[model samples]
Target: MTATSASTTSAGPAGVDVAQFADVTASDASLRRFLHGLPGVDQVGCEARAAGLGTRSIKTTAKAQALDLAIRMVDLTTLEGMDTPGKVRALASKAMRPDPADPTCPAAAAVCVYPDMVATAKDALGDSGVHVAAVATAFPSGRAALDIKLADTRDAVEAGADEIDMVIDRGAFLTGRYLQVFEEIVAVREACARPDGTAAHLKVIFETGELQTYDNVRRASWLAMMAGGDFIKTSTGKVQPAATLPVTLVMLEAVRDFRAQTGRMVGVKPAGGIRTAKDAIKYLVMVNEVVGQDWLDPDWFRFGASTLLNDLLMQRTKMTTGRYSGPDYFTLD
Candidate 1:
């Protein structure tokens, strides 16, 4: 329950003290026992809490602040097979200046794109303070071999990605091969290391929809954190049932508890299906309540979304000018 729990003095991935989890990751059997031993989620209670939080209202000034915060939290993203360099450049531009009409609009947290597009996004975002995040490790599916996955991550980091979002092997996770998934995450985290010795922040995607149970979600959250993931993400945005409130609640709890026990903080990102200012506000409230304000900043939380930015801008405009802006006022992602 503490960082000194393990007797070994070596450090693990992500600078976690190896001794803290020496017993837990000693072998596949030990990892399975430790993960399976975690407390099971109370499905009914979790959903009820999420629904209750979703109903809380913020009005006028508070709502205005929430909208701006949501805008800043967005990972303005585009990941499609047909995505072109021009489109990525446009997205990067939008990320740096979400609302051309207003100079005060805080830039989005980052522009998320495929590995091959990282350079383009990096070029467009150029010193704007908006990070370029690339999804690697066979993103959305994660069906490739470990070597290929590491290579995918290295390519992204080499291409100037400020962050690397790698998908976990959900199949291995579901089959209870906890160590395989853990090792792969560790490998990808290592691949994120840059020549300057600073590593690109690593976000491990769970694709929670495929994991099929709240318990598995909790286990995966702990597993990724133990393996040195800077962030534990809810989905790759390519799967159905992505980023549900209850699932995110479970993950938030995991990070809170992990920090309590290990003194290391891990971020949570709920990607996909969050499309409105109201939805983003609900998540903000949840993060405040479930993990405290420590995770409220863009550095600690993110909305992996495309359309969500437009809604935040619209709400922000309504608050500032007392009128609704048409969707045409914003560029469609």
Candidate 2:
């Protein structure tokens, strides 16, 4: 979709300031009209562009640099029903020192876990550069009441989470209750605030797989950005077809257009289905070509991954030794 300069920074559709869009939650029709009016996605064209970007050749020193950058941009994630204190600690350690054998490897951007594990993760990552991120708002399914969702967010923030990855109410969104979804995000964003005056950054997940169309992905991206999302994430990593290149491409285009219009930069995270160093580099290539060098840093981009870090470390090891290493050589996440 196209974003006009007047539409970006100062006000979104119908004179709503994107930086402070929480005011528009009163009307669903206004939000719906604004979202549906965004540029339609050409699915074939979008997929072709993603495939073309996937073919980029990165090797030698360039590959090495990409590997390190990808590592630093990872949100080393461990979201499972059986997640435990020990598992969170081990993952937190991995986030801090991805490659225990190599002191030079930088830490992952954050450690993403369930809200219940936020305190454990925060304590485990004490004094480390890595941030603690917790998934909230009923997590994979946004089927709970607004008060419950806000409570979920507050619990994580109170537990010392630095970031909150929240899933939107997909049922409401798909049913065309756009304002309901928007207000939910605004409420969650408010709950991210702490008594100390600092606030946890909010990453809103669209679960593109369920959205089922590039048009919906584009619309959702803009909706979240306008609603004050710090980052617009592709998927929850629990759904099928999570984090595909085409979905991510649509998001990157949205962010680029959004920034051009409002001068506000929103981060993008492609969670799920992204494995291997090659896949990670392909995504990085797409980001560079689509969003440009401005989003290359971890602060503006992230990969929500659990096993992806080990693969990156393995590739980084190969780049250093000129020989491929086995999975055993790297610590399991």
Candidate 3:
């Protein structure tokens, strides 16, 4: 195992309970076998596909291309707080429509709006095949009570969200309240689980910008996985000095290590500040080199971008015809 640098934060969160999770029992033998079973190209296979992949960093660049199925998880921060239920619904519908001129315009993974807009999104996506994801649990700043957070999660799911993105109590985690952070995630996971027999994917955002150290990021990733994060994400995009390559590398390796120990595949998403095709590709390459190419699929990887899709469309258009395309051609509006 690669040892990470020591954390500079003074042991995240106060009084967090850590020993309550059982998923930590997932052993290395089981995890390694599971990772090997997943499909992917090896170093040689990567080399073979690299030439056709279009970029020298095929591992990285491939993400934007494969991201035809991406979900732009955006916050509906309506000005003047004017989003009535109906207006919120319409906003979500508009957010999900993809550009047909682009071959990559399959369907978005979902329209991630506010909790109140989930039902609207669920209705908007309809049989149209997109999912409805909501950011819950005192989002942007997870400073609410446990009950309120859980209620926030339940309300979003009840409102028809297919998935939930919850913020980890960074204060708790940074203060070494790992156990409290773990418990908060576990409660939300339990609430989000389909008691009616369905299951919802949960993406836990570490907001790596605040963790301040690769070691802490690595430790936090491990804790989140142990507590049951279906996907581990870099930031909420609300933090400054957003998603950096080095921080993402730390998170990716944590996923790799978690898979090595748990026999499960946890996804990774680098949100916030990722606005260019090149930036998206860099994340793709990091996953390829660190986690292996099998995770190249949409199921194992995701990008929480707003402006990223447009840049990718423009780049793809330019590449196909050998010329530049106007920005208005791919308006995310």
Candidate 4:
């Protein structure tokens, strides 16, 4: 697949050039044509590539380093309805110190929770360098009206969330109402801004399982980036087949191509269904191979997970002390 170039100088939201993509998002037809015209995924080839990369192994010192990097790249998430302020505080504490036994262990990239929990998380993680991320736009369902969605985003931002993860209207996108989805993302991105001028970073969740095909994943990635999303995320962790290796591969390719085409970089987050340290390592390998070192940092790539941290801690302990620690040693998420 080749990167498509857009030429126009005017600036748009999130530093994107609006005029550059003006022709593409001019209307529903134009947006659909552009998204459809993009390269299609070769399912066999894509899955094959993911499988091959998954087999690449790290060992000894390299394995230890990979474990540390993976720990830092985690967005320690807890989105259950039963979540309490105390639970969020505990989660935030864990995010700041994943392995309390080992002070050398790196803190996670963020503590993700519902909008109502952002303030609790913020208070728990004050001045810790770890970010507070809130899932908005009606979260797992993204079924609310645009006004409600924007208000959700504003609530999170106002509550001191450093990042906002908004779900797109997959219903609209699937029905070929690409313009509607695009506009909603743009609006939410706007709502992430604080009164102090610096805005919470926006992570657009496509809930890729609902998107169905790899080709649609690519289309959604581009649409979110074009609409000023700082990051394009895979799932909401509430659906089947969340964040598969092949699907993430497609998204990695999209961000890589997008940066090449527009000179703007967007982050990718693969959420849910990734539980083991080994599984996280495979994703790290894929990111290295697919997009190179540029996306190796937490700022560019994050694993949206709750249970993955425990396994990583276990692996770290085993590597450090030459013995395996049972899962009981770590606090459950």
lDDT of 1: 0.91
TM-score of each: 0.97, 0.93, 0.76, 0.96
lDDT of 3 by residue, 1-333 (tens): 222233421211121222323333245443333333333323354334433332445433444354442333222222113546666565455455555665445555556667877776677667865667788888878889999988998899888877888999999777666667766787888778655756577889888889876667777777677667788888877888777766776677778866775456788877788887776676666677788977876667777765676776676666566787887886443
Q: Per-residue alpha-carbon lDDT of model 1 for 1-333, expressed as tens digits?
A: 234434456654446554567668889999998899999999999999999999998898888888888888999999999999999999999999999989999999999999999999999999999999999998889999889989999999999999999999988999888999988888888888887767899999999989899999999999999888999999999999899999999999999999988778999999999999999999999999999999999999999999999999998999889999998999999
Runs in model 1 deviating more than 4 A are 1-7, 12-14
lDDT for each candidate structure: 0.91, 0.87, 0.66, 0.91
Q: If both were scored by TM-score, which would come out higher, candidate 1 or candidate 3?
A: 1
Ranking of all candidate structures by their lDDT, best first: 4, 1, 2, 3
> In model 2, which regions exceed 4 Å deviation?
1-26
- The CA lDDT at 294 in model 4 is 91
Best by TM-score: 1
- Model 3 residue 41 distance off true place after TM-score fit, in angstroms: 27
Per-residue lDDT of 290 in model 3: 80
Candidate that beats the other on TM-score, 2 or 4, i.e. the better one: 4
Worst 10 residues of 1 by lDDT: 1-10
Q: Write the per-residue lDDT of candidate 2 for residues 1-333, one digit (tens) a residue.
A: 234444444532223354454334437766777788888999899999999999998878898899999999999999999999999999988889888888999889999999999999999999997999999999898888889989999999899999999999888889998887887787788788777666898999999989978999998998888778889998898899999998999999999998887678999999998889999999999999999999999999999988898889988988798888887988776
Model 4 CA lDDT for position 80: 96
